[model samples]
Target chain A: MGEIKTVIVVERNYLMQAGLEAMLMEIPGLMMVKTFTGDEVSLAGHIRKQQADVLILNPLALKEDPIVFLRKLKQIGKMVVFGLMEKETPVNLQSHFSHVLNVSDSKFDLQNKIRSVLHQDTRPGNHNLLSKREVTILKQVVLGLTNQEIADRLFLSIHTVTTHRKNINRKLGIKTVSGLTVYALMNHLVRMEEMGGATK
Target chain B: MLINKNMKLADVIHHDYTLVPVINRFGIHLGFGNFTIQEVCKEHNISTGFFVIILNAFHDPHYFPKERLQSIRLNILIEYLQKAHTDFLEDKIPEIAFLIEKMPGECLDDRKTYLLIRNFFLEYSTELKNHITKEEERVYPYVLKLEEAFLKGETDADIKKQIQDYPISAYEAEHENVEEKLFDLKNIIIKYLPKPKSDKLCFQILREIFSLEKELNEHARIEDLIIVPKVEAMENALKLKGFGNG
Candidate 1:
C-alpha cells in the first residue's frame, strides 16, 4: 500500500557493503536498516530479524551454492531478494531471484533495473521456458546449419534435432532465422562477433 | 621427536615435490629453496613469517639438522621447470614459426591465409609478452623480495609491503588472452585448412599448430595450479598485514 522504503544489505566485501549503504541512504524514502557480512546462514537470520522491505545480496557470499541459498531465501516469505551478479548470471538461477543486476553495468542502468524490480511491472510474462538443450539447438540454428547438419554434429537423429528446433521456435516465438540470430545476441546467448559466417 | 600437528613433515615433503613439476610446467623458474618453505607453510595455512623461519632452518644444514630435503625439493622444481616449460618452449617456438611460415600457401586465398597467419602471430606475441612482463615485473619481484626478507630476518611489515604490490591478475589475464586467441586460431584453421584443394604442406602446418596449442594449454594449467596459488597466498598474507587494504 505505502511506498517501499526499508533496505537491508547483505554483502561479503566490506568496501562494497559500505558503498551500497551510502548510496541507499542518499536515496530519499529509502532506509538501509542493517548491513551484514556473512554467508547464507547469517543472512537468513538477518532477514527474519530485520523484516526489511528489500534484501540486496552479493551472490558470492552464498559460497558456491547460490541456488540452494536462493531457495532458502524464497522460503523466508514475501521480501524481495536482488542479486548483484558479475558479467553473466547463470540462467537456471534467474528463476529464484526477483531480479539480477550486473555489477559492471553503468550506474544509470543499474538504478533503472533496481527501480523496475522495486516499483515497475516488468515481471516476466508466462512463456514456456526453453530447456538448456533447446537453447543449444537454437544457437546452432542461428549458426545457419540445417537440421541434418546439426543432428550429425550433436550425434542425434534428424528427427530429434528438428523437434528441438520446433520447440525452441514455438517457445521463444522466433519464426525466422534472422529472428533467432537477433534473440541470441539480445539475450547475450552468443556475441555478434562469434556468429562469424552465420550472419551472411 | 614430537611433530606439531601443523607440521606434518612427510606431507609437506610430498606436496613440495608434487608441486615442482607443476611450477616448472608453468615456465616459472624463480630458483629453488626460493619456494619450498613458503609453499609448505601455505599448504598448512601458516603465517608467511613462520614459513620464513622454516625456510631458514631448511637452508642452513646445521640449523634444524634434518636431511636437506628442501634442497632436494628445489632441485626437483628446477629440473621440472627446465624439462617441461623451458625445453618445451625451445622446441615449440621454432616449430610454431615454421608452421606459420608454411601455413599461408595452404589456404584457398592468399589474403585469407595471410590474415589468419598475421592474427595468430599478433595474438600469440601479445599474450606471451604480457605474461612474461607480469611475471618479471610483478610476480617474480615479489617472490624474490619475500625470499630476501626471509633471509634477512626482516619483520612481517617489510614482507607484507612487497606482497601487497604484487600483480596477481596479470598472469591470469594473460592466460585468458592466450586462451581466446588459441580458440580463434583453432577455429580458423579447422574451418579453412584441410579443404579438398589443400596440399600436404597445409596439413603438416595445421597439425603442428594444434600440438603447439595443446602444449600451451597444458602450460596454462600448470600456471593456474602451482604458480598462481603461491602468488595468491603471498598476496593474501600481505593484505592481512594492512597493506593494500584499499
Candidate 2:
C-alpha cells in the first residue's frame, strides 16, 4: 500500500462541500480529514495544523485575494493545492493549483486528476529523470562493474562513464554502489538472484 | 533575535538545544550556573567573537556573518571544522547506526528492507568519512600552506607548483556528491521504506538523519562562504606575485 495523504476540502456551499468530502473519502490513498468554509479564519493555518497533504478549495469562495492566499499556502510546505473550479472561474488559479477540478467533474475524473497530481508532486523534478544511457550505466554499476570495466564493455571513454555515473547518482538520489544496487533491486532493474554475493 | 556574546549561555541552549554539540566542539562544557556567552568563552579560552558567530550561524541557517568569518584565522576555522568532523564520525554516525542496527530485529518479517537501509546508511557514512579524510589529508593542509605562503609574501618552488597544479577551486566539487547521497538516504526512509514494526525507531532514525543533515549543511556553508573565498583571495594574491609561473 502507498502512503496515505490527508485531504481537506474548502467550499462555502454546503452541498458542494459535502459532495467533495464524500468523493475524496472514496479515493484509496486519501483520507478526507476536514471541511472548511472558504472564508474561514486562518484557513491556511488550520490546514497546516491539520498537516494536510492536499487542500481542495474553490477560488470563488476565498475572502482575500486568491493568488496571494494560494501562494501563502504553497509556502507552508509539501501539501498540494487543488483548485475546485466552475465552468467560468478565476483565471489566476491556474498558476497556483497543481490541478484544477471542475465542479461538474465526474467522481472518476476527480480521483484520477487528484491522484496524478499527488503522484507528480511526490517525484523529484522530471528534468532530472535518468536517461536511457544513464539507466544502462546504473545497471552496469549494480552488476558490480567498475567505471573502467563498464567503459570498456560499453565502448565508451572512462571520462564518459564517470560522467554517466554522476548523472545516475543525481537522478536516482543515491551515490554509493550498494545504494544503487538496492535501488535497482527495489525497482526490479535486476533480479534478487542476480545480486548474488554483492549484497551478502 | 540572533544570539550575541552577552546572552546567557543557558538562554542560548534553551533557544536551541541542538547547538549543544556545536558548543561542545569549542571545548566548552555544560554546567555553568549562569554565565553569559562572553564569560563562558573567556573562561574556556576560546575566541568569544568566533564562538558567538558559530552559535548564531548554527542556530539560524540564514545568520551567516560572511565578512566576519572571512576575517577569522584559517587554522582556527579549520580546527573548529575538524572538531565537527570528529563529532560526526565519532558521535553522530555511531549513534544513528546504533538505532538502525536494532531495526532489523524489530521488523523480522521484512528483514531484507531493514538490512538494505542499514547497508545504505553504512555506505553513506563511509563516503562521508572519505570526504572528511580528503579535506583533512589534502585540502585543509593545502589551504593552511597557502595562507602561510601568502602571509610571508613568498612561496617556495614546490608550494608555487602546488598552487598552479591543484588550485583550491578543484576541491569544491567533492562536497556535492556526499550531500546528495545523504539527501537520498533520508528520502528512501521517508518515502520508500516498507512499513517497519517499530514506528518509534524509524522516527528516531529520521530525527538523527535530520540533525546530521542540518549540521552538514552548516558545515558546507562555512566551507563554501568562508573558506573557499578566503583561499581564492590568497591564491589570486600569489598569482599576482607571479607564483603562477611554472
Candidate 3:
C-alpha cells in the first residue's frame, strides 16, 4: 500500500462498470473514487469536482463528441483519463488521451497502466524557477569550469560554488557537465563557440 | 566482454552485483551453486523471454529492439510498466516525502529552510500526480481504443472528427521538457537550505533522491523507447485505413 490514488470509472455499460469496480479493488494503491454512468448529467462537471486522480472512461457515454469532452479535460489538466471503448470501436486516441485501449483489455493491464499513469515524473511549475547566481553557475559549469575556478572568477567561496553546482543540477534536472552545456545551449545561455574544449 | 549460453546468473551478479536490482524483479536470487539462466527463471515462474532480454540489456544497454519489448505480446510490456508505476507512487514518492518531513525535527538550525524543502516536495508530488493523471485518464485509454480499432479494422466517425483538433503528435510534442520544480526542490535541499546537523540524515535523503531519480529515468525510458514506438506504429496503420484527420 503506497500513497493511495483515487480512480473513477465513466462508462455507459452496467456490467463493465461493475467488473471494473471489482478489478480496481484487487489492485493495491488504486482505490475506486467513484463510478459514473455515461447518461449522468454534467458528467464533465462531476469529473471536474471530484478529488479522484484517474478516470477510466468509455467514449460511448458521451455519444456525440467524446473527443470534445476530452479536449476540455485536457484543458482543465485535472484528473487524468483512461479511454474505455468497445473492443471493436475504431478510433485513434493517441492525440487526446495519455493512453487508449479497448474496454476488453485485461483487468491486470488496465490496473497496471493506471498505476503507471499515476506515477509519471511530471514537470514542475512556476517557470522562472532558478535564481540569477544559479544561472551563472550553470553557464560556468557548461563552460567546463571547476568549483575552485568558478570561485576564483566569481569571487565566491569554493563551498558556495559547490552548493550552487548541486543546486543547478537539481533545478535544471541535469547532472553531467555535458548535459548542462546542452541545457545552456538550448536556453541560449551560451553559444557553441563558447563551449570549452570538453565537447570538442 | 563475452556472452555465452553457459554463463551463470550467479556469475553475472557476482561480477557486478549491481545487476541485482535490474533482474531482481524477475525473482532471480543469490546463493545459487551453478544454475543456468534458463534453469532459475523456470523455477521462479519468470518469463524466460523477459529474463534473457534483461541479460542482454545488462550486457549492452544500447542493445536495440530489446528483444523482449519487441518479441513478446504488447500486454507483457504494459504489465511491466504497471508494476514499475506501482513501485514509484506507492513506495518511492511516499518515502521521499517522509524523509523530507523528518529533517525539520532533526535539525533545528536548518528548521526554517527545511519547511521550504518539504513544501516543494509536496508541490512536486502533486504535479507528478497531475501528469500521471492526464495520461492515465486520457492518453492510455486512447491508445487502448486505437488497439481495439486496429484489431477490428474499423473506427467511428465521431472519434475521427475529434482527432482532427487533438492528435498524438501534439501530446508527444509536450512530453520532452523535464520536470522543472523537481530539480528546484532537490537543489533547495542541496544548496539553498541550511545543512542538517546530522550528516547521516542528509546522506540518507540524498541516497533516496538519487534512487528516485534513477527509477524515474528508467520509467521514462520504457515509455519513450518501448511504449511510444508501439503506439506510433498502431497510429500510422490507422491513418492508412483512411481515418487520416481529413
Q: What TM-score is obtained for chain B in each of the predicted models?
A: 0.53, 0.95, 0.77
Candidates 1 and 3 compared: the better one by TM-score is: 3
What docking tier does model 3 reach? incorrect
Ranking by TM-score: 2, 3, 1
- Indicate which candidate wins on lDDT: 2
Q: What's the lDDT for residue A157 in model 2?
A: 100
Best by DockQ: 2
What TM-score number comes out for model 2?
Answer: 0.64
Fnat score for model 1: 0.00
Please provide TM-scores computed only on chain A for all of the candidate models, following their numbering: 0.53, 0.58, 0.55
Worst 10 residues of 2 chain B by lDDT: B172-181
Output the better candidate (1/2) by lDDT. Answer: 2
lDDT of each: 0.56, 0.79, 0.65
Flag regions of model 3 displaced more than 4 Å: A1-200, B1-35, B54-68, B156-165, B176-178, B242-246
The candidates, ranked best first by lDDT, are 2, 3, 1
Candidates 1 and 3 compared: the better one by lDDT is 3
